[model samples]
Target: MQSRREFLQSCLATPLLLNNFRYSDEKIITVLGEVTTSQLGPALIHEHILVDFIGADKISSNRWEHSQVISKVLPYLTEIKNRGIKTLVECTPAYIGRDVLLLEKISKQSGIHIITNTGYYGASDNKYLPPWAFRETPVQLARRWISESVNGIEGSKIRPGFIKIGVNPGPLSPMHQKLVKAAALTHLETGLTICSHTGPAIPAFEQIELLEKEGVHPGAFVWVHANSSDTNNFIKAAKMGAWISLDGISDDSLLKNAEIIHLLKTENLLNKVLISHDAGWYKPGEENGGEFRGFTTISDKLLPLLKTKGFTNADLDQLMLKNPVQMLSVRVRKT
Candidate 1:
């Protein structure tokens, strides 16, 4: 077996072969359009540029000032960029304040690669989901996502970089199963990764089963917020070849994340680990961006702590750089 350091070095030498095949022709979609994997350095996999489920259906009398949002979030984005974060994946799906225009503006001005997603967040009680989504079958939902991935979202030229879906805790809900199926279909079509926001191991495993049933690779699935889950469960998911995203990185979860990383290293599963703050929320029509958090904790704080906990520079680089490129890159089918 190749050591982690040796694997990372080989990948760095010839990145196109990192996926075990050639992906030099592939490009990762961003808010401003497509960019190559080499261009996506030090990414925050799960963060939100704008999220407002409170006023989903109502357009009028809403507090969404474009200029205010831009002005308030620019400084925060700048801080993230200064912290050496080049790519920021905005996980705010449609109907939940997924303002692509706002994200494009932020990306352009901030000069950070901002990648948005395409999918229905069905984790909640069908509130964020549109009426049409509930009535549509899994195939219909998959078609919509396929169109968004191939063409553009909402008639715009900007396309989504990946599929972002969600499910409630415990057993799989009907809608949740459909969402997972749709995500799997989208992955099969577009080769984009599916980032699922799951509460616990049960839903995560169910999603894995559904994706496997759809013939999607286990690596195509990302278990978002895996930090909130139990250690054994996360390790189980990681062993199955899924990307375990510990995205809720913050000052509060510093030591906790360090411990988890230590465990993954011990299990020799560090290659599948991903880390991010899951921070950044720009509420429209809000004063001062509504309790916004900077995206510097991972690079600034958590990394140094992890190093002290015996995680070497190679391990951290694999988590932040190589792992992200592998996850975000579209997986080509073996012919």
Candidate 2:
């Protein structure tokens, strides 16, 4: 049997064999399962279906009945679906409330495509990482993640759609470098895109350099939380072929987010930009699943604001539809 990577490359390389070149040819992995890129309309690149940061060490204690969590979150997801967001990437990473089963359930119940990720996110405080990560080499870490992408996460048949990782705010720590390098290695093996929780530009550049050193193109990387960084650095990275994800959109920050979007538009780099709320999730062990920020915020708020600021429907399509397909699609490495 041809591997999924090989199958995608074969199909993508021969567009006439299918039909159109861009949308119809590419496939993306979602939480419920896989779907063609054409099926992912008006997508959100970053959102969590559930989160358990407080119980990182004891996930069991944080665990709630799946139905209860689903009941709390499904309505919000349904509202997002009603607003026309077809796909959503669940950014929750392992050891940090990354629950694939719950995500799958949410996707099914809400009638949305949810793409879950594979990779550890121990960047902020390093507490989310398992003890073994501190001792493992980069190759070992890569191999484990590669297995998840090739096989399935935690032995479930649901494979991860992308590589999710993060580093500390400033200099890349030893562990951070290892995790980024591992994401690079896994990308090489699986052709999956790497979405790292990066910020403050310099560290994002460091990550791009590390991936480049490993022969992974910057196009395969996503600089998450990019709106928090300097505009100059954001443009620089986008020009370098990295996906600059301005994922901090909200009601209060629409104008602020619009400023960055306008900058990207002026630079003619809108093709490289992605936007989302970084919002909405059921917090385990919280009343009413803790403040569930509906995932439809971007669609409801910022998008119209962008239109008023001179983003044509075509530009909005690129940001909401086409850019995501390109960013999420598995890139065939040049041979």
Say which candidate scores most in lDDT.
2
TM-score of predicted model 1?
0.90
Q: Give the least accurate 10-residue stretch of model 1, judged by summed lDDT.
A: 14-23
lDDT tens readout by residue for model 2, 1-335: 88755644443332111123267576798876778877877789998877787645777533678878888888787787766678888999998888787777777778888998988886767888888788999899999998988788887888999999988889898889999988988999988999999878788999999899988999999999988798999889999899999998888888889989998999999999999999887887788778888876677667666766877667777888888889898764421
Task: Please report, in order, the local distance difference test score of every candidate based on alpha carbons.
Answer: 0.81, 0.82
User: Which residue segments of model 1 deviate by more than 4 Å?
Assistant: 1-25, 59-63, 332-335
Candidate 1, residues 1-335, lDDT tens digits: the string is 88756654443332211233223656889978888877887788888877886734663224576777888788888887766678888998878888777788888889999988899888777677888888999899999999988888888888999999988878899888999988887888888899988868889999888888888878888998887788998889899898999999999989998899889989999889988888888765566657888788887677767766776666777777778888898764311
lDDT of 1: 0.81
How does each model score on TM-score?
A: 0.90, 0.91
